[model samples]
Target: MASAALIESSLSGIPVKRGKVRDVYDFGDRLLFVATDRISAFDWILSPGIPDKGRVLTQISRFWFERFESVSNHLLSMNPADVPLPDDADLEALSGRCMVVRKTEVIPFECVVRGYLSGSGWKDYLATGAVCGIDLLEGLQQSDQLPEPLFTPATKAETGHDENVSFQTMSDAIGQELAEKLRDLSIQIYQQGSEYAQQRGIILADTKFEFGILDGEPILIDEVLTPDSSRFWPADRYQPGGAQLSLDKQFVRDWLETTTWDKNSPPPPLPEEIVSKTREKYFEAYKMLTGKECTW
Candidate 1:
């Protein structure tokens, strides 16, 4: 089941910026998003891309985008066959991983929500008895489900760790009104997604969503809750006061922690076993949530 990993798309379109995962191409009024199999850890894009990673990421995102239609998003189409490209451009590599979307002015902050205590949010809570400056009751152990979800926003970083900022700081940076809107929408989306996933035997511990403004109205953009952007733990094995097994990139992160490679600088390449297992984790998340096998 080793599928081709498209580290980069060969399709031709007006040039746009490339990110750690998706490469975007400008097409006049629309944009083309090609999610590659590229995987990044500690902010470094590693070598030997995971097989079929792009297909899983793109398709899982499409499932969430379609399910959350109540929240307007930038998505236009996910079918590569329907996406227009220049003559002679090969789209075989982009199948099931391409999105043609309406372009908009992207908001610069990360809209994050946490249903469970984990990751950096756990670290923040341990030190401050609060996460993102929101006071929480003490004695909340690691991986413990929060009494209620909290809107914790971070500034998206280009080359380093995304700095977690308080709601007041976010309001100071963006207008208070706009900041409040993003917070509300982020919580709503996370709660709904978490509830659905819980019923399906997955715990969406936390997830991030991006939004952009189209004609002065905020619309969800970028990738919404994918394994790369969220922490998904299997419900059956869930435990508190410690780390939980996840079907997300955190699995790779846990492996990386045992390595001699420092969080800074270039990351080491993944072994065949690691890559294979990681691919299974990603595809399984897609299958478990969407209830359909990836066509690839």
Candidate 2:
């Protein structure tokens, strides 16, 4: 693992905010979002970093931003030449992983939309017969496609996992009008992304979106449509029963499940083979979904 100082030396300065996998540096009115090589599983940051993980995620997000521009506006300048990067900076080093974005006040909630039953939704359904406060028909199996996509809003927790909240709770948090707008826009974005992925032989099972307010208008912020934010399954192998193959970090999760390491403690380090395979999976997903090679 790279030391914190080593990571900091690679950047212009220390990050203003350090998340699990990305680092954010304040750059005047804009921000530099740098995706690191770190990999996390079971909500824990593991050892033995995966090479090019950042690049793969960055490429995936960039591809989606371009693809969705016809349907909605994203906070992207899309001009590498205009960015105020250091003269001696190695842009290639940051390839497939970094973005210079206009800074905006992020929303308080994580707008999650689901088209399939799995993960927390499946657990919630099995336990309480509801998912994000939406009741499902009895006998819905894992990975079963829902009749229609549903907007399952959640409150963004400060330092831990987010909690699913009812629609009424969301409305109370952000007012009825904004909540309604968020729901509508979330479902619209999901539908467009899901449909596009389906055409490319990938099933966008579900994904979470984050929005920010800029000039009193809501604009998409953070990464969009990446494997980190959504589950991608190969269309050819997808079945209504059993667990669906993930297009992203499914390998890491599978390895963790096999070990006796408790989810509460830090996850074990990934072996070189697992890291390489995971990186390949990410690249394969990008190529399959966008029909473009991941040059990085």
Candidate 3:
């Protein structure tokens, strides 16, 4: 039997900040991040969340956090029980899907690094020959690898798609020194992740990172390099002319495109088959990347 999905988490006496797929509980010195099974596409949260989706995401992030220990990050503990919780809190539900992290003032921009021409980047290149103000060579097909990875920063929107902006724009909003540092760091991490994923027979096409100010220095925060934040493609099935199979929520997006519902309205509830397949894809990514089955 399949496990019931956790769409939302309600803890007593804890002030929580709920995003589309995660609930962040404020705990004075630290924060508890609970990844729910809720899935979103076209910026709309869909119904009937995928089973064990949150566990896969949280575990994958934990794997990367441990692997990148030399890198400064906000992860303090993976055990939610380490922090205070209500007497009625469900430890079983939170076991594999929560993180106790140092609280930091989150930066307002998404540090996106793209190594392939796809999605919005391909669309932007087709129309303007540039992506977020960085010009690329002509004649590049969809899914084609770029000459070099580009650090494209985007404004973090609360309720809609993150709008891509130029590096200069990011510098203007923040500062030149900080912006340059984030750009360099974003590209560096992307390169390391991409190379490693290729060895696992998966291609890390693009990814976005969130950073925060911790004790006067920038540290990586939020979910790290998971499928929800990065594009993962099977190396054996890749082609450059058009869309390739991805191991993420792209399955949900593709299914929605086949339906008549306009993206302006709330998305339709995902079918059972779609939900199951989506869950399988997320789990497959976790296994391939970590070399361990997603037991959670």
Candidate 4:
């Protein structure tokens, strides 16, 4: 369970909106998004928390926000000190783990683009030879890079996992003009992110991005390119025939796979050793991908 003090301290003076792992606060026209020390697997929040997980995620997202600033407009504001934080806010202690961002009305879709076939895409491919209604090239192996990336948008689900929707479906929901713009921006961000990660010995297998409309224009909101939002694979260890080694939460997922716990049931508490190792993996990814220290 999350600590009451931690929750209250973080969400003070803001209307709390609870997600699986993050506690969001509405701060008038802006929002205070706090990454909690919670870990979730199989859509369930695990009992044991991963140390420094929040800071690592925050740092990675900030790094990508900076890297992609030239290409798109993101929700981040550069001057943290100028922003109005609570008087007793522990800003220094929460460095690199939180963001004070301009709040906009979020879109109803989750923008997903895949450069490679894997995970849910692979599952869909084996079932129907298509992913999110996009037909795949024949004989494409698992983890094989596509000839070109595809924009497969999905409708955001309210109570469960996001349901993959076709481009046509997206057009029906948000109209052809806005849908096309979202697709273009999604591919641009993914291309920049994949290229940058490739230089850092990591292959960004795929990633999800969220966008919101501000003053009648689309702006990128929420975190970008973090392990929680994207899948990271070691470039050298990536193999097509088997599961690729991940630099993210693979350790926890793998451990859970070996247990008898049903996926529908709440996951068992992770052991202390597993928690420590997972935290180290997050830290390692931050250092390797960003080329900066995990200060927290």
Top model by TM-score, which number? 3
Encode model 3's per-residue lDDT on 141-242: one tens digit a residue: 999999999998999987889999888999998899999999998888889888889999899999999999988888999998898999999999999999
lDDT of 2 at 65: 78
lDDT for model 4, on a 0 to 1 scale? 0.78
- Candidate 4, residue 209: Cα displacement in angstroms equals 0.3
Give residue 59's lDDT in candidate 3 (0 to 100). 93
On lDDT, the stronger of 2 and 3 is: 3
List, residue by residue over 1-296, the lDDT tens digit for candidate 2.
41221132155543468776777767678877778777766667778767777767777787777877753434465443345766766666565467778888888999999999988999999998989778889999999999999899888764567888888998997889888988999899899999999999999999999888888777777778887788899999999877988887766888888889988876777777787777778888889987987665
After superposition, which runs of candidate 3 have C-alpha atoms over 4 Å from their true positions?
none
Query: Cα deviation of 144 in candidate 3 (Å)?
Result: 0.2
Most accurate candidate by lDDT = 3
Candidate 1 lDDT over 1-296, as tens digits, reads 68777788775545767888888887778898988899998888988898788878888888899999899998888865555677877667777788889999988889999999999989999999998888999899999999999898899886667888888888998899999999999999999999999998999999988889999989998887789999999999998989999999898889899999987777888888889899999988988999998778
Q: Where's the lowest-lDDT run of ten residues in candidate 2?
A: 1-10
Clashing pairs in 4: none
Report the poorest 10 consecutive residues by lDDT, candidate 4.
1-10
Error of 4 at 282 (Å): 1.2
For each candidate, what is the lDDT? Answer: 0.87, 0.78, 0.92, 0.78
Residue 204 of model 3 has an lDDT of: 95
